[model samples]
Target chain A: MVSEFRIRTETESNMAKQSGSNKSRLYVPEPPFRPGDTPDYSHISVPAAHSPVRPDPLCDADETRDHATSLIRVMRFNGETQGDWVPGISPEIKRTALRDIALTRAMDERMFTMQRQGKMSFYMKSTGEEAVSVGHSLALQDTDMIFPTYRQQGILINRGASMKEMMCQCLSNSGDPLDGKSIPVLYSFKKHGFFSISGNLGTQLIQGVGWAMASAYKNSDEIASVFTGEGATAEGDFHYALNFASTYRAPCIINVVNNQWAISSFQGIAAGEGETFAARGTGYGLATLRVDGNDVLAVYAATEWAAERARRGGGATLIEHFTYRKSGHSTSDDPSKYRPESEPDVWPFGDPLERLKTHLILIGEWDEERHVELLESCKKQVRETYKSAEAMGNLSGETRVNDFTMFEQVYEHALPHLDEQKRMFAQERD
Target chain B: MPQMNMIEAIRDALDVKMSQDSDVLVFGEDVGYFGGVFRATAGLQETHGLHRCFDTPISEGGIVGIAIGMAANGLRPVAEIQFADYIYPAYDQIASEAARLRYRSNGDFTAPITIRTPVGGGIYGGTTHSQSPEALFTHIAGLKTIIPSNPYDAKGMLIDAIEDNDPVLFLEPKRLYNGPFYGDPHAPAKTWRGHELGEVPSGHYTVPIGEARKISKGGDVTILAYGTMVWVAQKVAEDMGLEADILDLRSLLPLDIEAIEKSVKKTGRCVILHEATRTSGFGAELAAQVQERCFYALEAPIQRVTGWDTPYPHAQEWAYFPGPKRVGNALRSVMEG
Candidate 1:
């Protein structure tokens, strides 16, 4: 027994010696900044303004690989459009884009407050990610279908979805267009080319590719745009979309909003520690671009480039929009748990609203007084819309969704079972 | 009319739909060039153009999600999942996107997509390839689940499922692809030549989505079955000399409640049969509904003959399946009381 103990101890020592010599251990990824740590932006690297030159839309996909690694920026920090990537647009359109961005942020704030006040169930804010959707919306045609994530409410807002109706959907009130079928923020403005927002992530990517394929098959010029976060790129559907997109050369644009964080986890968990999300597109032989998402001009210009490419028979283009999630992931999330409170302040790219406003002011297109007035006007309009939606009914009040809605739309042609259920439910409610 | 098997019937439905409507497209893994693994989509690519019938990567989520997109854009997409076992990966897309499109969009958008999968055991496929997932799809609110036991019903129901304005899960019993599986490993495969439900028409005909076919009529006991169990129950009843009213419940969702109530009340006895596991299988739903609707008229408690609650094993499948003896015992028990 003593000899056995000796041998076991000897073996243990031997393993310790081997491990000490090898120094091998499991590698766990850690976030750049943890809670209680001072927020730091030194690790992040952003390319100079307009570092990537604009290529011809018809250029071979392989020729645009470099664009996937470097950043494409049009608006500088000093409020001037720079380099060849600048999209020449009239002042009216730029002002309209700015207005839509403000409106989106205003709506997000109102909805967030409503959730806190027990008037709504949930809310997700696009606080720092506004440019990604608004820029794409302004660049694409109104008929171009968009399969967007919940954070891209700017698509519907820019397309003129009624603010009152949107508020009613959040409240699940009488004026709710969906008749209380979906949860809050799952908006579907089908007539405005806004595809229904699916709570499941990464589903819309393949859907966008398929929509583009159908449009191509029908010989239509209309293209499709899909949005997903950086973390969703790890899903199998993302890879499938790229494979189908490259094989069929579907006319679509895949926008990956790399907002630095995915819920509680950081972006590194999805893209790995060493690789960029934009590099994934180049691997699939797709035309790719990495844009500064906080720079509204850059986002707009990049979307226009990809949209034009898709319109003229070019294949899909993947654009990685680098930004940060300024607020928590949603009302239910607490950013302080996973990230330093100071992270948003030290973000490399500033706020999207401020960047666009600075550009407009730099070009003498507007003044500070006008900016204040626009901000107040957006807040007041959203507040009024909320009041009207509340008048229709809140969750606890008289809702517009009837008992029959549960059985309705299960099929376009109602089966006997559903018909019976509808009648029974109506009687029970009465 | 041409006599065909279940696989042939499926292929005929695709051919008919593609020929009639230019908007219908067929796609899935290996469906374009090699036909499907089970040959259910054989000759479709050749008959239709490559654009209309094509292959996709072995990504079920992408297949279903992309098909939903096509359906929303005014195309009827028939997506083939190689097996029911591999369909779990696509459940999110099928349940969240395609099923809810019309409801979420308030009738502005609808996904007219049909997902076809070969289901059931008895092919020595083990746990990976054989699974009866009809219950999973049936539980989804906006999805329709259909299973056909014979060639005629296979063709007619598949055509109707494809042309339907909502998402349908067309589950083909892999065991009944070429011949009916009566749960006897030693017995020779039975072709549809002499079967009552085998005479399939060449052109378009539809077995409506919500009706049940009364295969045989007797008043002693009512037997409800679908897919492989329908044949198994029929064979069991004949062998046992039991006067059974055998009903083929083709559609699990949107069930024929009227027919079920009528038959169960008249017979005063019921035995539910399925190859899926006994617990929480579709048979349970049938039993609960039967008891709820015809409890006062029932002379005996409803009995269920189903596969055991275990993964389908390769060598021990026969023991796990609800074979003739098990079904016969259930029939006797119900009739005796």
Candidate 2:
């Protein structure tokens, strides 16, 4: 046995050491553009319009794997709209949608300026993500509830929520429905089928599912839709909602507004560099779609498909609105500190407002003169609404919330201790 | 009326409420098919059907999160954490989401949820299984923390908690599930038999929250205890034949301050007892209140008998527990002063 044994060579140990050095290393994702760097989106590969496969609305969840990976684009770069994802929206609805989007932008611009002028404490503008909410709102029924995030102001604008009420809320005036308890932009309209917005991110996801389950339990035809940013998808509530929705076959649509940035962090920090947020759905056995959030038609069509699926008892659909945050995270944030200052201008998806307007013009349904006149009118309306809202008071304290209101709604029926506290507070005031 | 222990009383209360309200749901890990670890939810799924009572994944955070959502959306959700020690995972949902829903939304929306969990230690379940976290929840403003000492209180308080339109933390003393434990670990346990506290009504009833019960009235001293500590203090008082006023503090958050002040003023001496660790224990709050209210009537500094400041030990459970000997010694010292 000793005579038959072969001798080991020096290259063998060297090869082992070389293989150890070639082992895979940990991966850390960084955005393509950083501060002072040139913005580059060439790494993103979007398919041509109508190129991705489309499964039926009621198809098995397993069949949506390819749809999750591919982008469902309806409006091409040349302003031509041609695709299976192009919804059959009438000219009247299209005009209304465009008007509402313009109004939202105008309102946002006014509120942002107000924050700078110290009229409001804070504001978040949905500069590039308007179509995600507006189109989805147009697709859903009036009775269907929506659990929205702070950025979905377009939903309220599209749903005909009063601009005066919105401005009053921002002002935290006496006319504010929440009694000036909530912060600016966190609106609640229970009668309008809009659940209250929570400042803690990702809470609305499960709330939406629970509401849908309640609707189903009541044997109603209504459904629910919830929205969150891509960074919020990393939250545990989002995953919990997916599991509950998939297992219970809840009738709801979960949306991820992938606007690329979350405050100081990028979307890559949410573990989204390797795959689309829409892919998160297919992994949970859900019918999912990745739609061009800039294209109103694409957003409308995908939302309609998902809602139809939910209504027909096909369970939930997760839609990733492929878009970018074209502004700072909020009035308090300065995006220039992290990302390149010119990134928004060089964004590949283009502005949602611009794309929708161009498509309408190319189809001969709209013109530049009408668009400008509409913008001016929207600005005038916002100005008038802001004037009335400020008369009630702004964040600068021309008016204040009634001290008694702080103790009024803590509980439906105030406990003895609360009543005593209220009495003590009144005595102190006296 | 039928005689039953705290565990059965809790289950019966859930069954009664769920039977009346279709919107009421009882769900947790192993609650449906397995009927829960200690069988607190036994026969619920069979009686209510899986639609109303079902098992969820082993995710405490998800359990509380979904329950909050369900409660906000027209369902009266009673979600159970397997144990009090496991509730930290769901603390955010309970504290931030459920508790603050109505306050944050200014009454536009509310999360009326009841979180049920078995708490405290007597069984040798070691550190992970034995933690009394009543103070953690009691510190939350919008939450109602209720602890039940016996069968009757358990059923009545649970029913009231379910009906209350706020998030309620219903902590059931697990060691008292089948038998009454009165501080002496080696003493023969008292089942519902021959105990008046065991005779719970089969029909629906409610014991209002934020009210304390005067178990025994005397002019010598006031002994404030709740949950298992109530039994321990009562046992020691009877064994020593001490003429003391015993008050059971069922609700900790909206504490029955009037009853506490009345007892402390009458007795002129106070001893607070609980099974939780001494530092920041609920006993501290009671001691503060007693001192503040009865500053002139005090015969001695308010004394507290509580568990040591360490993790609940497995083999040395009695050493850590504020048992009969500890409470007896504290009572004697307060009275002699």
Candidate 3:
């Protein structure tokens, strides 16, 4: 019955990802009790494969091996000691996180400024909720894949991605690594292990699981991490990815940075319980964790643990970091209309950088003089970088914004009529 | 020279191409091990190994998305949708990812992916399992749409689809998958080239994408059809004793309007037929094109004997499809006018 249909392939990106591996056959056992072809469920025929693949381990370091603990383990790991106010992690990683956090925050502020000045069309900020994205991204191995929602650009920011490169991409310049194939928010950097970012709200979650399953089957030991807001967890891909990851033990770490809002809708509207998004993972029989998203140390620890667990073939873990967006959803939004003015003006409340600064001060690892010195130098450097990028000229000089005819990437070999279309473009260009 | 049916020819083409290029892979549901649901890729998994030929999850979007990823990185992938009816679930990926890959990437990356599926219905596939959704894809600028009427063309067109750089939609007529009867396989291996005339190549060859096939030469009436309807139109012409020039459209977008005009110019009359619903069907496009180009050469108005604007009912499939009898009946009406 499976042999009664055919797949039409010609032209473009209709290819499926398969590695060079000989695993178990798709094992289609004969259906013995053949109920008369009456449709069960939405005349939508789901091809059956009852057999599952066994999870395989990866070659790793002793630290990575011992770190085969889920996000929840990391969340609970020093929870008692966390209140003791001792700073965890090396001095260097902390400063680096602090620096990345500051840069991304500045980038957003500048982006909004540019939007107000009409330099670009649109931009989404990583302000306030920086640590979950900026901090956790640093924990990933170079080979690990990250699928970021718009706000998660901070993940790229934290990965040493250049300010100039980010500016060029948003400007859609020729220097943009995405080569104008991407829209502003939906971006992909194949070299950075970033799969194509999707504009469809919850779609990348499923794609992350699929890539992880493929990686697991290939024994690559590479985990796929995808970002979404607390609100996006309500989408089907969240539950679908979690269930698939748990059932197959695919190397996927699902992160929901509970930034408390998806655009204008409050996170509470997404779920009645208001429990951390990570706790939702437990109902699906997988490991889960909820952490202070503002705390860079917490985000890093959770990510490090989840990555190692995935590398060890222990399956997926869900991490929900509690954070807040200090800026609007994008450059065009006004958070003031939605956000209340007052907050508990204390050291431990809603501020990711402040918590780290407090811990640093308590441990005597960081000094106020050093923070002031770094802030002055970093802000100057950021301002200079933006000036240099702006000097490269707008998109019209850097790249042709009108270059829209692009069908060649759909397929490797050219189709006949499309050749004609290309000829037309060549003529127009000439 | 080797001639075969559409399904067997597709398998032979996959085998030949897979053997030729280390990069070419074939996969989808049931495509591995058991071959495709329509057997278009039978024996590929055993012959090519799992990497080059394998089954994927039931997630159609995943199937196409991964295909896009693989193609973007550099691998020629041939993915199958079990049926055209089921392509909607994966529609966004094809439209947003596969088709737009090059345009969006600004030529830095190319998807170079081929999507193969069995489309159209005359077999008792009912509504859900059978549909000619090619129009949905052909309407998309970045896609190339193809439908083969015979084994030789099926093999040639599919290989063309696999080789072409842009996304191609290869539609195999399931009703014609085994060929000319109530429950008979529309395209059995024995009658692979049953509808196709002339010698077929044994080596790697392409029939050229976006080219139409002229099956019969006549001067009185031009019968424009595709997939199983090409053979149906030919059979009807034979039975009706009408000298109908039949054009088998191998490609839809970048449509061979020249071929249609040449036939209609001499024949002075035109008729279009297909199993898809009449409203907004491929026939509608053909009728519109023929009228635009061949209006002055008209002996009569362009006629379309297509499936009525209704679902492909389980009981009345024969009535729904433009069979030989229906084409013959419609041919007389157009010729007389």
Candidate 4:
């Protein structure tokens, strides 16, 4: 059968040659810097901070077409605030933002250590992309719903969710709100307006739009904010969410946290080659903004702008937070195998935490002594929270999730089959 | 009571539910202005206004995903997939997001969305339009799969589904949209105008989900079926002069196992039927359940009368469809045993 198929293919090839048809070739996108390559960002155009003009929240989507390609940055490198995008808040607010960002980093560090120590199954760290989640959380109202991926645990921390509860979730202990049903780091806090985190990527984008649509349909001022990585923009759900948000004018902020990597695959593989990820929103007629995610001020200002637009019924805004992933994708990933270790250090957008800290110090609201004190306080708080969470029970401990509880929430009312199965399980246990 | 087809009954259910509860919104591709290609949502947009019942872009994932979000936000959304065959695009959203939302969140959030889509293969829709994908949903833990055979059950069960707190996949058999199909295509198509099951009430009513309705009671053999296959089983039993206890399983997931066990134990024989492909179809689950529960009773091995393993072919549709002949053969074989 194989030889006969080969002969037919040869005949077809001859016919194609006679017809003068060109042979089709497949093209796969390759990232510029690989494992051993010396990474360079000189080819990337880093515009002056705050160069992109901030448009009116209610401005026409077409007026912001250039914003998709241009970068929106609020803080300059020398700890100076620049341009119209700067969120002119008091020093106190900046200090709070810095504290939240630092605490998020500190929590990520501790949870990552716990996973490595065999206390939890896995972990994902938003090491350098803190501004994207913390800034947005600060900008949006606590009432507005948030649909977040796993990496945005910073949102919960900034929303004042219990550090102990968050740690317990990571530990998959008895105190875990999900009863250890979900994997480690996939947290769900409804009271904090944080949607349950799904490990499956790209599904929450449309749900966010739908929530926003429901809010609008009910004439509620509360909007929704959703986040995904740059790679998930290729998922059909992302495009579908964009189209629905634009058509219905759903009051939502669609954020693409373009941290430049999805696991090992680079942004180019998700069709982020010639155009920006924010540019993909333009085709859906959404107001789009590409902001320097490392700039916490820019992140906050952009999220506030989008939230205001959504509240005033100006419709959805797609904001691409351009940043870099400093750590490996997750506990399971090893970035050294795919990309150069030097890439994170040479990333055009510097660390979000350092940038915010520098801005605070340059403005005379903070100093090296206070920074050290704050870091120590954050580490101590995380350590205490981890201790409290570990007391409830860790994944490796005996006080784990009750196996019989698995049959409890499958439905609101118990069915006969589930009841029978539960009885069987109880019998076996007894 | 008024005579209504399955489509009209479904529309009436949506209309009634929308009127009763302002939080219940209906939207899907072409379901707003056009009232759906199947017309199951006709007049809903005009009556409920655009915000309550609106059209969406042609994106199945978006449709179901948006429904999940809406449900999470305390709105009971009834979204329609144009056809069950087109539901694959939204499978991830349904299986991963909608089904697991409540469980994953530990009851912090719930997806009370009703996804209504026409299913089955008698309309010559061939591969793309003809499909019975209920088994796929039945395999999922959190989703409630309901397939109603007639207009009364369709309307009542749909209302029940929308009111339920969990996600429900309401699979409407398209072949029985306007009438009853008793497995004979050539025997002039019958309308639901005069049928007893078509006499649906105009106002609010609900046929409880997770409960099966015994269409006929007999002693020889027990037939388990749902949707279009229910009527086909009834016709086959009558034609073969077999004393068959036909049970219409309205809900597939939270199945009516008690009713099945009772009838199977009494009859001492069982025949499962569905329009889906034979391999790993819902019939397989039914047969397995019956065997597991009724193994002590001396009886013939359960028979499954279902569509062929091949895709629903356009040219050889009858060959692929498990018609009355196939169902009758199963019944005769079980009776002989």
**Per-residue lDDT over A1-430 for candidate 1, one digit per residue giving the tens place of the 0 to 100 score:** 0111011223344555665555665545567568998876654555554377788999999878988877888887788888878898888888988999999999999999889988878889999989888888999999999999989998888899998988888888879888887889988888889988888889889999999999998898899999999989999889988888888899999999999888998887786666678889988999998888998888899999999999999899999998889999999999999999988988878899998999999999977999999999999999998898889887765766675676677779888877877788878888
Q: Which candidate tops TM-score?
A: 4
TM-score of chain B of 3: 0.93
Per-prediction TM-score to the true structure, in the order listed: 0.94, 0.95, 0.78, 0.96
| Per-residue lDDT of model 4, residues B237-269, tens digit only | 888888889999998989999999999999999
lDDT of 2 at A245: 91
Query: What is the lDDT of every predicted structure here?
Result: 0.88, 0.86, 0.68, 0.90
Cα deviation of B145, candidate 3, in Å: 2.8
Top-DockQ structure, candidate number: 4
Worst 10 residues of 1 chain A by lDDT: A1-10
For each candidate, the DockQ is: 0.66, 0.61, 0.17, 0.77
Model 1 residue B180 lDDT score: 83
Give one clash count per candidate, in the order shown.
1, 0, 52, 0
In model 2, pairs of residues that clash are none
Q: Write the per-residue lDDT of candidate 4 for residues A1-430, one digit (tens) a residue.
A: 1111011223344555553355643445667678988987665656764368998999999988988988888888778988988897889888888999999999999989989988988999999999889988989899999999988987888899998888888888899888888888888999999999998999999999999988998889899999999989899888989999999999999999989899999887787357888888999899999888998999999999999998998999999998999999999999999999999999877898899999999999999999999999999999998998899998776547788788978888787889999999999989
Candidate 2 chain A, run of 10 with poorest lDDT: A1-10
Worst 10 residues of 3 chain A by lDDT: A3-12
Model 3: how far residue A111 lies from native, Å: 0.6
Give the per-residue lDDT of model 2 (tens digit) for B167-259: 999998898888788887777777877689899999799999999999998888899998889888888998899888999999987899999
Give the better candidate number (1 or 3) by DockQ: 1
Q: Going through the candidates in order, state the TM-score of chain A alone for each one.
A: 0.93, 0.93, 0.75, 0.94
Ranked candidates, highest TM-score first? 4, 2, 1, 3
Name the lDDT value of residue A30 in candidate 2. Answer: 63
Score residue B276 of candidate 1 by CA lDDT.
Answer: 90
- Classify candidate 1 by CAPRI docking class: medium
Q: What CA root-mean-square deviation does each model show from the true structure?
A: 6.1, 6.3, 13.5, 5.9
